[model samples]
Target: MPKVTCHNICDAIAAAPLPDGMHTKLIGIDGCGGSGKSTLARQLAQDIGARVIPTDDFAAWDCPLEWHDRFMAQVIGPFQANQPARYQRYDWHSRTLANWITVPAGGTVIIEGVSAIRQLFRPALAYKIYVETPRAIRLARGLARDGADAWPMWQGWMAEEDAYVAAELPAKQADLVIDGTQPLAAR
Candidate 1:
């Protein structure tokens, strides 16, 4: 297992060359709740000038896994054909679908969330990163981030996510596993 601070990951990503011959490369970042998947994805995107497509932005709050068809139509289809892709955004406040988003071509596209690396999307990804953090620390972080009022629901959601991942075994299939508990050191 290779352990890295967050800054080190960013440094490594900045030094890496963009994939050859492809207008867009999809990177999947999957992790347990509060394991810092989004944070790392954002940093990587900033370092590499890549587009960050958060899976949360596409998913329904109550049913996150049901957006695979949307992802296929929006992201995968466009990148595969070397065309710009667009998809609707989920409005968390109104609990309704929002305006469309256009994903431009010719850079890395990071799809990040709990199930971003699911079996359905794995084949299309150029690289897949799984983030690991101790359960207790994750729960504490989640509780702090979401608040006590939302902790119960968050815990339930995590349980459901865990069950799904257990059946799918996403970690075993990932290209890299990142230790997310530690902060990224300044390089």
Candidate 2:
């Protein structure tokens, strides 16, 4: 795999040809929990003037990866039609769909999180990136952010992520694989 550093990612994206008939450049950043997907998405969005639609906005403690349908209906549908998209974000604290967010069409939009690059969205994506991090490091990061009290829940979520990796092989399909162990700046 070729090295894709934060410094050069914008240049790389600019150089890659978009698929024919694609009006919007949809980029998917997929990784297990705490693998730095969100971090990369934010930085890349800033650099490229893109909007981010996190899968976490649709995910919950009970439903991890099954939120694809909601994403398809709310985001992809409108994006395909070259119109603005709106969706309710699932608040982790309230456990409800809170706050509607409207993302304008055109330019780049990043769909990021665990299972963000699932098969259903691949045909529309201009680029796919997967972040690979060790289980121990990811668990440590998750515990730190979500607190140790959510240990059991985190364990279950990690198991689901493992199953997704086994079945989907997202990394194998990625146009770029980022090493989560290294800081993007260092890369």
Best by TM-score: 2
Q: Per-model C-alpha lDDT, please?
A: 0.79, 0.89
RMSD of each: 2.6, 1.5
Per-residue alpha-carbon lDDT of model 2 for 43-156, expressed as tens digits? 999988988999999999999888999899999878888878799999999999999999998899999999988888888788899999999999999999999998999988
Backbone N/Cα/C clashes per model: 2, 0
Instruction: Return model 1's CA RMSD, one decimal.
Output: 2.6
Runs in model 2 deviating more than 4 A are 1-3
Task: Score residue 124 of candidate 2 by CA lDDT.
Answer: 78
lDDT of 1 by residue, 1-187 (tens): 4456556665554454544445677888998888989888887787777888888887754875678888889987778778888989898778898999998976778899888888988767778888888888888888888688877677677877788679777788887787787765545
In the predicted model 1, the residue pairs found to clash are 6-184, 7-184
Q: Local error of candidate 1 at 148, Å?
A: 1.7
87: Cα error in model 2, Å: 0.6
